[model samples]
Target: MTDTMNAVAYSHALPIDDPTSLEDVTLPVPAVGPHDLLVKVVAVSVNPADVKVRSDMDPDGVPTVLGFDAAGTVAAVGSDVTLYAVGDEVYYAGAMGRSGSNAELQAVDERIVGTKPKSATFAEAAALPLTTLTAWEGLFDKLKLTAESMGTLLVVGGAGGVGSMIIQLLKARTPGIRIVASAGREASQEWVRSLGADEVVRHGEHLTEDVKRVAPEGIDYIYSTNTVGQMDAYIEILNPFGEIVATDNPGLVDLGLFAGKSLSWHSELMFTRSVFTTADMVVQHELLTTVGEMMDAGTIRSTMTSAFSPLNAEQLRLAHASVETGRTLGKVVVTNEPLAS
Candidate 1:
């Protein structure tokens, strides 16, 4: 109900250590467009995209708001919005083209939003949207893996948010699929294993040896949450008809490695549908809802392992710094208060 709201924004890119990198500003509450819902943001989660946007802002462009994942209550709905109503608690990863959920309130398309799990707090729900969307699309959509398939899944960077979620979803839904995750540290190794990875290996070390130690044969599906270039050594370990899906853009990779094995390669970008308004845009809504149901059923758990209180520039900066390190065990969330159940 407030006319103005507090937000963290930047007109130019600056290093995380710079005092001006992120600023607290007051702006008029945004009005919702048709098919959009205005949300009162209670919590936000930081991803690598948020760090990239904050540190890589174009000087010539407008001041950019740089948050993606949000869990909040609906403040108002546009005239054409029929999926959600005021006071409904929802979770979503907002599109890249518009103002993001870093503000006190944001206007987001209802098609991408889903009802938050009643069993989860706002911060927990906030941690799910971005990472879950990326992992779900990478495995099921890009790689075309189904729950009925019987095979092994290898997740690189398994300790990270998307990787952790991918491991959990596959273990919960896919029968007879063995999951082998790559993590260097003990904490990360234990974290992914706890999330249902059948086996864990160190990334920088030899992947083939570690994986072979567990399954003896090669893996059937590979989801690389780390850089693609880091995956070259493991391609040969993929089965003849195996599929590899990666979200990281490592420039100029040789395709011959996969071609020889008759393997398929896929690049998954969670923003693709929202950016292009693709024919299958509603698939995101369906996936998010499914994820919420799984969460309610206790088949999957939120990846939110760390939380910062009082959503503000300093707290957001800290979260961004943590994500930029690329060593976080799970998703990091920033909330206005300790999330209420």
Candidate 2:
């Protein structure tokens, strides 16, 4: 193996349009840890977290690799790694504290990695880990939803990557639960509906009315992707003792909004398990494996909407641009290979 390999990194946070914001450089291939898998990344997907980190991280003049979701093959495994072996195909969302998947090779913990779906292409599989983990953790771990769970779920920004997974996970895991997804555009509305949202409504000013019209009695749960400015609408539509789970930072909001009805709020960050080195961090591997089974069984589908290839600085830049548009239908993937056309 080469001592150094090509990677896309940013030394400073800047707009995506800036040439230096993401640069092609060479860095040492990460060494495998005690429980690590040395993976040759085949493809990667861009997420809002990538955008936020690129714009917010103070790299302090050090080039920082910035990718979270990836699908790859294990080229080597650490001596203590029991979960995977060299030559095994795997997928995972990288830990926040570690170097990311933008590079040709990445060393990630085996506990968080899952077998890539046999039915999925590398680009398609790369789109699953981050969003899938976030949605699963939100619904099962935090929301404590079960197969027998019953209620109307209001998914704010349903056409998004995370929202898309939330809707499908609810459908596959809780068959009786009703899902109402909110989207502002016709295409987005259709997109969410196609993903099994029982009801679709325009977001923004009409949020309450749209939710009320479909749910009538108020929503029992809320999964919001963009929580920054939607607290008021969430407070209005949620039922007494209801719950809200969000994947994004809400910034400053009136916490008292939940007090009125004894409502509860939960924040879901897939990175929490890896970031804190939690005891049950391997749950990500379990859930991702389940998702892969579901994929092979045709119960769910990949959300990749756009694709770019040959994983490089320019491709990463285009993928980031697609995510920054805030209107990407599903996920935008960058692969090490060309599209089949």
Candidate 3:
């Protein structure tokens, strides 16, 4: 293996349109830790997390690579790693504090990695890791949903990456539950319906009215993917003791608003387990395994909406730009052209 690998990184927190925001560079390939797998990254997907890190975190002019999701083949395994070996196909969202998947090679913990679905291409599988993990954790873990769950779930921002996954996971995992998604645009509304949403609401001053129109009984659960200026509407339309799980932080929200209904709020962060090295980090592996099996069985599908080839600074910048627009139909993936020696 070459000592150095091609990568894209940000030396400053600048706007996506700025030419210096992301740059092409060469760095030494990361060393594999005992629990780490050295993956030859073939494809990667851009999440809002990547865009946030690029626009909000300054590295003091140091190059900070920012990619969360990856699909690749294991080039080597550390001594203590038993989950995979050389040449095993894998996909994962790497930990937050460590280097990410923007490189041609990356070292990620095996407990958080999963075997890629046999039916998917590298790009398709790459799109699944970050958004899939986020949606799964929000629905099953945060909302405490199960196969027997029955009631209505309102998914805010259902046309985005996490929302698309949330709609599909609810359908696959809890068939008895009905899903209502919010989308402002006609195309986005159709997009969520194709993914299994039973009803679609518009996001506006009339948001609560639309929810009331679709499910007059009130929402039993809410997965709030975008909660800017809409928490009041949620409280008004949610049933007593209903649960709401959010992935976005929409500034300072009044916590006391839910007291009237005795409602609860929960937040989901997919990076929590790996960043803290929790004992249940293996849960990510298991859940991802389940998702892979579901994909292979044709029960669920990939969310990839756009693709780019020959991984480099130019292609990566384009991917980040698309994600920042907040209008992407689903996930966007970029494939690596073979790295030069």
* Top candidate (TM-score): 2
What lDDT tens digits, residue by residue, belong to model 2 across residues 208-277? 8888888898999999887877888888888899999988788987778789899998998898899899
| Predicted candidate 1 versus true structure: per-residue lDDT over 1-341, tens digit per residue | 88888898877788887877877888888878998999999999998888887877655545567899999999999999888899999999999888988999999988889889999999999999988999988877777667777888899989998998999988887867889999988999889989999888878557878888886788888888776456666676788888888888877887786777888888998888889988878788888988999999999999999998889898888888888888898899999976445
Task: Please list the C-alpha lDDT of all candidates, in the order they appear.
Answer: 0.87, 0.91, 0.91
Residue-wise lDDT of candidate 3 within 143-240, one digit each (tens)?
88899889999999899999999999999889999999999889999999999999999986878999999999999999988888888888999999
User: Candidate order by TM-score, highest to lowest?
Assistant: 2, 3, 1
TM-score of every prediction relative to native: 0.95, 0.97, 0.97
- Runs with alpha carbons beyond 4 Å of true place in candidate 1: 60-62, 339-341
Q: In model 2, where do residues sit more than 4 Å from their true spots? A: none
Instruction: In angstroms, give how far residue 49 of model 1 lies from its true place.
Output: 1.0
After superposition, candidate 3 runs with Cα above 4 Å error: 337-341
The clash number for model 2 is: 0
